[model samples]
Target: MEIELKPINIIFIAFCNNPKCKNTISIDVEEDTPKDDEITITCEECGNSIRISYEVDTI
Candidate 1:
Protein backbone atom coordinates (compact mmCIF):
# COMPACT_ATOMS: atom_id res chain seq x y z
CA MET A 1 0.00 0.00 0.00
CA GLU A 2 1.10 3.50 -0.78
CA ILE A 3 0.38 6.66 1.17
CA GLU A 4 -0.42 10.02 -0.27
CA LEU A 5 1.42 13.13 0.75
CA LYS A 6 -0.23 16.50 1.13
CA PRO A 7 1.37 19.91 1.14
CA ILE A 8 0.92 22.34 3.99
CA ASN A 9 1.51 26.09 4.22
CA ILE A 10 2.67 27.99 7.31
CA ILE A 11 4.03 31.49 7.78
CA PHE A 12 6.38 32.53 10.57
CA ILE A 13 8.49 35.58 11.16
CA ALA A 14 11.46 35.39 13.53
CA PHE A 15 13.58 38.32 14.51
CA CYS A 16 17.10 38.21 15.86
CA ASN A 17 17.85 39.87 19.22
CA ASN A 18 21.32 40.95 18.29
CA PRO A 19 21.46 44.70 17.84
CA LYS A 20 24.10 44.58 15.16
CA CYS A 21 22.33 41.82 13.25
CA LYS A 22 18.63 42.47 13.28
CA ASN A 23 17.59 39.89 10.77
CA THR A 24 14.13 38.63 9.93
CA ILE A 25 13.51 34.96 9.36
CA SER A 26 10.70 32.96 7.81
CA ILE A 27 9.80 29.33 8.30
CA ASP A 28 7.30 26.81 6.92
CA VAL A 29 5.62 24.25 9.14
CA GLU A 30 3.27 21.31 8.92
CA GLU A 31 -0.51 21.50 8.94
CA ASP A 32 -2.51 22.16 12.14
CA THR A 33 0.51 23.72 13.78
CA PRO A 34 0.05 25.50 17.08
CA LYS A 35 -0.39 29.25 16.76
CA ASP A 36 0.66 30.07 20.32
CA ASP A 37 3.83 28.02 20.05
CA GLU A 38 7.24 29.31 20.89
CA ILE A 39 9.85 28.63 18.22
CA THR A 40 13.54 29.03 18.83
CA ILE A 41 15.73 29.97 15.91
CA THR A 42 19.41 30.61 15.59
CA CYS A 43 20.84 33.59 13.79
CA GLU A 44 23.30 32.83 11.03
CA GLU A 45 25.10 36.14 11.13
CA CYS A 46 25.21 36.72 14.86
CA GLY A 47 25.08 33.06 15.90
CA ASN A 48 22.56 33.84 18.60
CA SER A 49 19.40 31.98 19.49
CA ILE A 50 16.05 33.77 19.75
CA ARG A 51 12.56 32.76 20.67
CA ILE A 52 9.44 33.88 18.83
CA SER A 53 5.77 33.35 19.50
CA TYR A 54 2.64 34.25 17.56
CA GLU A 55 -1.03 33.47 17.27
CA VAL A 56 -2.97 32.34 14.26
CA ASP A 57 -6.50 33.66 13.93
CA THR A 58 -8.83 31.19 12.34
CA ILE A 59 -12.01 32.47 10.81
Candidate 2:
Protein backbone atom coordinates (compact mmCIF):
# COMPACT_ATOMS: atom_id res chain seq x y z
CA MET A 1 0.00 0.00 0.00
CA GLU A 2 1.07 3.54 -0.74
CA ILE A 3 0.10 6.82 0.80
CA GLU A 4 -0.13 10.19 -0.83
CA LEU A 5 0.09 13.65 0.60
CA LYS A 6 -1.44 16.95 -0.36
CA PRO A 7 0.47 20.08 -1.28
CA ILE A 8 0.43 23.32 0.69
CA ASN A 9 0.89 26.91 -0.51
CA ILE A 10 2.56 29.69 1.44
CA ILE A 11 3.84 33.21 0.90
CA PHE A 12 6.79 35.01 2.45
CA ILE A 13 7.72 38.69 2.68
CA ALA A 14 11.16 39.92 3.72
CA PHE A 15 12.37 43.43 4.48
CA CYS A 16 15.38 45.00 6.07
CA ASN A 17 15.04 46.91 9.35
CA ASN A 18 18.17 48.96 9.01
CA PRO A 19 17.49 52.53 8.05
CA LYS A 20 20.51 52.65 5.74
CA CYS A 21 19.74 49.29 4.12
CA LYS A 22 16.05 49.17 3.49
CA ASN A 23 16.03 46.31 1.03
CA THR A 24 13.11 44.03 0.33
CA ILE A 25 13.09 40.30 -0.27
CA SER A 26 10.23 37.99 -1.11
CA ILE A 27 9.93 34.27 -1.68
CA ASP A 28 7.35 31.61 -2.28
CA VAL A 29 6.99 28.11 -0.88
CA GLU A 30 8.29 25.51 -3.28
CA GLU A 31 9.18 22.07 -1.93
CA ASP A 32 8.77 22.11 1.84
CA THR A 33 8.06 24.47 4.73
CA PRO A 34 10.28 25.73 7.50
CA LYS A 35 10.93 23.77 10.68
CA ASP A 36 8.08 25.49 12.50
CA ASP A 37 4.84 27.18 11.50
CA GLU A 38 6.73 30.48 11.71
CA ILE A 39 9.75 31.43 9.65
CA THR A 40 12.50 33.94 10.28
CA ILE A 41 14.60 35.34 7.43
CA THR A 42 17.72 37.42 7.72
CA CYS A 43 18.55 40.38 5.58
CA GLU A 44 21.56 39.87 3.39
CA GLU A 45 22.67 43.49 3.38
CA CYS A 46 22.26 44.38 7.08
CA GLY A 47 21.98 40.92 8.66
CA ASN A 48 18.59 41.75 10.14
CA SER A 49 16.08 39.02 10.73
CA ILE A 50 12.37 39.24 10.07
CA ARG A 51 9.72 36.90 11.40
CA ILE A 52 6.86 35.77 9.20
CA SER A 53 3.86 33.54 9.65
CA TYR A 54 2.85 30.72 7.36
CA GLU A 55 -0.65 29.55 6.49
CA VAL A 56 -1.95 26.66 4.44
CA ASP A 57 -5.16 26.37 2.49
CA THR A 58 -7.16 23.40 1.22
CA ILE A 59 -9.35 23.29 -1.84
Task: Say which candidate scores most in TM-score.
Answer: 2
- Candidate 2 Cα errors over 4 Å, as ranges: 1-11, 34-36
lDDT of 1 by residue, 1-59 (tens): 98776544776778877888878877676577766677777778788887767665654
Q: How accurate is candidate 1 locally (lDDT)?
A: 0.73
Looking at model 2, residue 22 earns an lDDT score of 78
lDDT, model 2, position 14: 70
Error of 2 at 54 (Å): 1.6
Q: Cα RMSD (Å) per model? A: 6.0, 4.1
Model 2: lDDT equals: 0.71
Highest lDDT scorer? 1
- Lowest summed lDDT window (length 10), candidate 2: 27-36
TM-score of each: 0.56, 0.61
Clash counts per candidate, in order, are 0, 0
